[model samples]
Target: MERSFTVDVFKVVAAQLIVWHHFSAYGPMSEAMTLQWPQLIEWLYRYARLAVQVFLVVGGFLAAQSVMNKPMTHPVIHIFNRYLRLVPIYIFALSLISLVVAILRTDIHADWLPSAPTFSHFLAHALLVHDLFDIEALSSGAWYVAIDFQLFVVLVVLCNRLQPYGVRVLSLGVALLCVASMWWFNRIDELDIWAIYFFAAYGLGVLAAWAKRSAFDAAVFWITVLLAVGALWIEYRTRLSLALITAVWLTIKPKSRVHWTPMKRVVHRLANSAYVLFLTHFGVIVVFSALWNIGHFHDPVTAFALTGFAWGCAVGLGLFLHEKAEIPVHHWLSHQSKLMFLRLTN
Candidate 1:
């Protein structure tokens, strides 16, 4: 199936927003920045949480589409393929952090690491259940990965059992469940934020996949966008949960085709590297912040610039890893998956 340029563009923008969200955290910016730049960085950050929702939706749509089209008899092979895709890079990131801790003698939290490098933690991470149970942090930002994996598992089972109708029902059910869960768990400080956001956003994506071409009304689309913006503003003021629900609904419309020469190519590449970027960017920031003495750079301008540079380095490294390690590993895993499927079927 041909990939949607609209989704690709959204992915790229979302990844950039993720980077910016982290960068803003590192910078010495105030809440007034939101008031000053209502449209650009401020507003984006205010609603930036929506980007992850977009990703989850896209993931659900794609995963359901693939599974419905290609029903795997031995799903374990497919699961193993996913394991191979993520675990190596996760371990690499962990190793990098371990090295940093050893070298800097930083007062790092031991809870982040496994008590014993025993098969349990590795298996937990390999299965993407580490964060679900709060076992270990393979990478600081691995909660999303864990949530994605869990959603994929749930989606696969639902798709196989319910077929096409399963996709629609699951999508709607999860979306409602997401909202309900948020309402119920709003007071629970220890709830996993990634899981909640992923379920809601991914449900929307599944809904989009099952959406008929004629279902999209331009009038409704525009109105939804306006509502999303309005909801975001209200969210900022009242911290109401419905704001997120509105924003998720607005993102379901097909993206417009905006032509740009090198821009598309750049975004596609970034989208591919988004996983690596997410996993490794924190370490990059820590390293750069240490080197630049970000503490000394009290000026927000200097701090933001330095943070951008750090993110750039992280993106570059992620791109490098994607080209050199991730792509090759993915290819190998795909091949092995096919072989494993054949063996199992035979």
Candidate 2:
């Protein structure tokens, strides 16, 4: 199946939504703005996290594409490569976040953002095990990156082990895992630190990819959807519904094109750099919020307007960090990781 144009557009929208949600959520300004737009703030706080499900489904779809073309003969090496790709930029973001948190520790106090960091806390982030350790996350939405990595490893392992049997077997196993998540695992938020809780959304992406296959059995697709829906019905979850909808939409196999027009290129660029945006955005917000504190505006509207400006600055910084730092760091680290993997395995 050709990649869908929806993926690119969704990335851009979701990135903005998540960032805005954070913007309206964390700072003292967020509190002041709430008096003016309570309903809007309330709505964003409730629904914005669901945007993650959209990315989950898309990630699942793209992950299936990654492993479907070839068996993962070196799942270990593939996992190492995945970690290398993620960790370089991740470490950079974490360092910046740590510095921001240290500098602003006395200036701001938001309930959700990270506090003063310690050595062990930093280690947990470096290892992507902050969630597992129940450590306060250093940056907004960082846990998702760790979970995304784990989920990909799970998929790679499953496909590599089942490729001998066939795609059908792999699809069935994945669907069953999703059902388990929606029904049992997701019910327990504590388990969310693991990837199992999010698997339903992620697995739907894989299922959607298989559903598009020429050889896919129709039963596989419908059964997966049915079990997952029934689980949601038994215990309705709005977030699950968002993911369910995203997965169903992907199954449509929407039209996509690469016109490479200026606008289209911009969309494609944002889509590709969305992760960098996600990773680096929080520090931007913290830094801007610190600067925001220096002024005392008589009107909260001016404060809110400046909040909008801060949002723009955050997006711009994320883009610059991706192009200048993330790309170069990943290229070097991943190349070295591959060479080291070959030397060790050879």
Q: What is the C-alpha lDDT of each candidate?
A: 0.58, 0.81
Q: Which candidate is the best by lDDT?
A: 2
All-Cα superposition RMSD per candidate: 6.0, 1.9
Q: 1-346, model 2: which lDDT tens digit per residue? A: 4545678888888888898888777876777778888888888877886798888888888888777768778788778778888887888888888888788766666566677788998788878899887888888878988999989988988888887798778888888888889899888988887888899889988888778675464467668788878988899988788888888887775545646678877887788778988888788778767766655543568658878888777777777888898888888887788788779889
Q: List, in order, the clash count of every candidate structure.
A: 0, 0
Q: How close is every model to the real structure, measured as TM-score?
A: 0.72, 0.94
Best by TM-score: 2
In TM-score terms, candidate 1 sits at 0.72
Segments of candidate 1 deviating more than 4 angstroms = 26-50, 105-123, 136-138, 164-197, 213-260, 294-299
Predicted candidate 1 versus true structure: per-residue lDDT over 59-128, tens digit per residue: 7666655664565555665566666776777777766754664543343233333233446766776667
Runs with alpha carbons beyond 4 Å of true place in candidate 2 = 1-3, 109-113, 215-218
Error of 2 at 208 (Å): 1.2
